[model samples]
Target: MKWYALLVVLMVGLGLQAQEEKDIVVKRTLHLMGSTFEISVVAPTEEIGYINIDEAVSEIKRIEALISSWDENSETSKINRNAGIQPVKVSRELFLLIERSKKISEITDGAFDISYASMDNIWKYDGTMDKMPTASDVKASIEKIGHQKIILDPDEQTVFLQKEGMRIGFGAIGKGYAADMAKELLISKGVKGGIVNASGDLTTWGTRETGEKWMVGITNPVEKNKIYSWLPVVESSVATSGNYEKYIVFKGEKYSHIIDPRTGYPTKGVTSVSIFSKRAELCDALATAVFIMGRDSGIHLINQLDGVEVVLVDGDNKIHKSAGIVFDTNQYVEK
Candidate 1:
């Protein structure tokens, strides 16, 4: 009788441990820079332990305060305000982010430019009907959109935009950077095996409780909830950029919200681009750059880089993928 009771207790304990290994989801919403950001983290309930969600939220807000351009007192805003004159010293963190952004600019040959904010908000895509801007207007906008004008002083940890009206915003890279930082923070706090999902930009570490990989659904551009393909992701970051979010129709032509800095016009040929990389920051910036570069150049760029893969959907819904991506064709409806 004593032996049977001990065996029963051991079995119950094992069952509880197994149950705890199931995936746990924690989410929070915070208002930052006039936008509501929804952050979700998924991890095993077991392992080392769980991180304090409140602490994670506070850390995210701290990063937001440092990087948000809408804040007049932010490091980036100060540098923008002092453009064309002297370099304004900034925090080491901001300086490193700027340096990384500049490297991406070089890699994409200005296709992923940070100076794009210099362009005037001439193209309105919010359901307004109007003819396309004139040639002169386009030319004027392109004149101020050169990444070459940005100067960095490593000694002073400063950034200087050569044009007075020039500005640098991290609309493309901020969320991914935030996700990376949050993941690092969580890991440092001894929380292992988790995912930090910032909207569509997602980064995951470790396998699920069943020892299987985390499954990520790549959304179809035409259909919001419908996933065109499901990819197994682990210890990788995925980011997607599509023109379907915001666009304008002018003279029977549709233009995307993502404008090419070089020509000051919407990029053509590609409709959506999804990038898989080890770093969330690179994945984030490259997704935008690849979308702007179109299918051919985008493929060339991803192929040249090691450990980076791409899945591109053209305007006509044709899907193109890099050699590195592995998945089942039957799971997706081929276009």
Candidate 2:
């Protein structure tokens, strides 16, 4: 599971008129899709709020059934099973998701790839490895991993992998996509306000019960207990990728779990990457991509795109932001 870099800070007031039309914020935290999910919604009454949360949970489960590569019966698993032999027909929704993933792969210059699931587990950060894998083995680990090799048939809605061992997984963007879908479902039902936070990759729509925008606290990677800034989010998504939690130190150098599929090596020089975009899926993929791209190049790419912004923390624990991001200078606290 991805580290939780952004925390949803709920701001509720104590003084309120009893007769006023109050929108209650109801929230539930549960384990889903192998990660923690916090679903919140505003409703006219407590009873209705619970109902809406239940509906949102059901919608998330439905999406997991469709996209989870771990389930052997899922469409993604079928595509992986049929790799190199034949094309497997899938739902149009799955096909489109794969299509968008491939586009991101191209945009990031192969830094982000869904086929990274095909990589061999040569380097372990679980305290099992004392030395780095040989260069040849490291290179061979990514032999079957390439998003460019995934072939899609639009008319038939079929996906094929060029290599037999090739596979695809949505570990990076799946939760964000699920969060977006849940938020949209609530919106369609006329729910005015809510937040679907899939372990830090979160989306918000409408206002809080107090009519204020949702506040997302960006945690300091160096000091996890402290927040560096508060971002007001309205009808937008945010995702953060950080390597401070799980990593291995080899020869006094740190290697994180997030690997670069292109080079089959762990990325360096960046501690955390947070991307803000209109869609959670985009933010999710770009968060991982930009982390692998390093600080300067990541900022350069984010500046080129419209409706996108980035805030990154370099290895020295310094904060960097894109052209559009504005944060209070005094709020930044480094190690």
TM-scores of the candidates in the order shown = 0.86, 0.94
Look at candidate 2 and tell me the lDDT of residue 13. 32
The alpha-carbon lDDT assigned to residue 274 of candidate 1 equals: 80
Write down the TM-score for model 2.
Answer: 0.94
lDDT by residue (1-335, candidate 2, tens digit) is 36544433333332222325776777889899999888888789889988998889999998999999889999999999999999999998899999999999998999899999999999887789998899999999999999989999998889999999899999888988999999888999999988888887888899777777787666665666666677777799888898867899988988888899999999999888888988888999999999999998899999999999998989898888999988863675432
| Cand. 2 Cα-lDDT | 0.86
RMSD, candidate 2, Å:
2.4
The local lDDT score (0 to 100) that residue 230 gets in candidate 2 is 79
lDDT of each: 0.72, 0.86
Clashing residue pairs found in predicted model 2: none
List, residue by residue over 50-168, the lDDT tens digit for candidate 1: 34455566777777788888889888888888988789999999999989999999999998987777888778776774778888998998787777898989987878999888988
Q: Native-vs-model 1 lDDT? A: 0.72
Q: Model 1 reaches what TM-score against the true structure?
A: 0.86
